[model samples]
Target: MSIQTELTEQLNRYSVDFIRFVDVSALPEEQNKGFPYAILFGIALTPEYIQEITNQPDYIQQKIKREAIHRDEFHLKERKTDRLADELADFLTQKGFTAYSQSEENLAQTGSYNEAIQQTSLPHKTIAHLAGMGWMGKHDLLVTPEYGSAVSMCTVLTDAPLETVLYSPEESMCGECQVCVDVCVPGALKGKTWNIKTSRDEIVDIAHCTTCLRCLVMCPWTQRYAQRPVAVR
Candidate 1:
């Protein structure tokens, strides 16, 4: 097998789903146009996991206080996912490519305000564009036949030349589904355009997002769907 395929296989051994290789050398010009390549490791955070966290006193207290927890505690259950991202980075470094985590802050720093605005559209759309996942819905989350939006994504950037796979972008499947938009307490979803720029323009007085995962947790699409086991190949 080729090196990239071997790498994908190795990643699969860790139960990573949807491994993709992205070539970002062209990003300077594209400027958030989309990545040339990206490795998408899918993680399904089940309702059980959510319930467990919700049951924690500290988590409940933090939620009540509307405070953000420290990263260590915030991602306590996601350590394995973070490690996967790190391991992928290390592997890419060994292969002579630079890699870094693409956090929201990182996105803001690299791209202009406009670029960041564009990113808020939908994670699944971005993933699907890279052929890492599938189409999204009005809830602004990706929907796959298997996993719904319960999947978390980690991306890997590399200079390595790898074969690309193409999947036609799926149409928006959220036909007349305004449940996500209507249920948002802070009204983050304003029907017209979900871009960050439009968001800022709509509510300049709002300081920050409510961070309420109401939109995330209340989605019928996510709750009703049966998740595909994301085992590493």
Candidate 2:
């Protein structure tokens, strides 16, 4: 089997919802840390959990339940993605390639989502966009056609000679969709349309966000994921 195929198969064995090998050499050298390639992968959050959080009537109660779900379900999937990253890195190392997983450091900062975003040198959202797994949403989250923004992502940097795709920063797919912006109680979303040149701060005011996740829950793409027939895993 091809190395890329073999690696993808292994990731699938671990229930990775999405996987991509991408050439990250286009990123600033300091950002990628001289790694020519990266393995980007994600695990989806439980739709039922998201639905419950989305359907809660009381805003305060929704926030409370969202925190519990983030702690139990979201972080648990993050840990799972971390483990998969480590395993993939080890697998590459065993084959005489240089590999490093970023999951452990990112997980350490998972106590606060905003903190994690602030501290990450190469955000997984950036990597996911580079990998063509998704586009940047108006809410500044990576919105995949499949799972929307409901997937927790992980990354592994490597010097392995795995085949990789190179894509220009894709144009945003979220055409005129403002559900996430309108639902932001803190008015954190600026209702800006994203393009390759648009900065995260242009679309979202992180300082103003309370991380209430109303945007995440009300997002139409996320709703599609939640309402889709459950797959028998």
User: Scored by CA lDDT, what does every candidate get?
Assistant: 0.54, 0.80
Q: After superposition on all CA atoms, what RMSD does each candidate show versus the true structure?
A: 5.7, 3.6
lDDT for each residue of candidate 1 in 36-139, tens digit (9 for 90 to 100): 55566766667654444434524434655775444423244245655676677687778776665444444456553345345433232464445635555455
**Would you estimate the TM-scores of all the predictions?**
0.67, 0.84
Q: Model 2: which ten-residue window has the lowest total lDDT?
A: 105-114
lDDT against true structure, model 2: 0.80
**Model 2 clash pairs?**
none
Candidate that would win on lDDT: 2
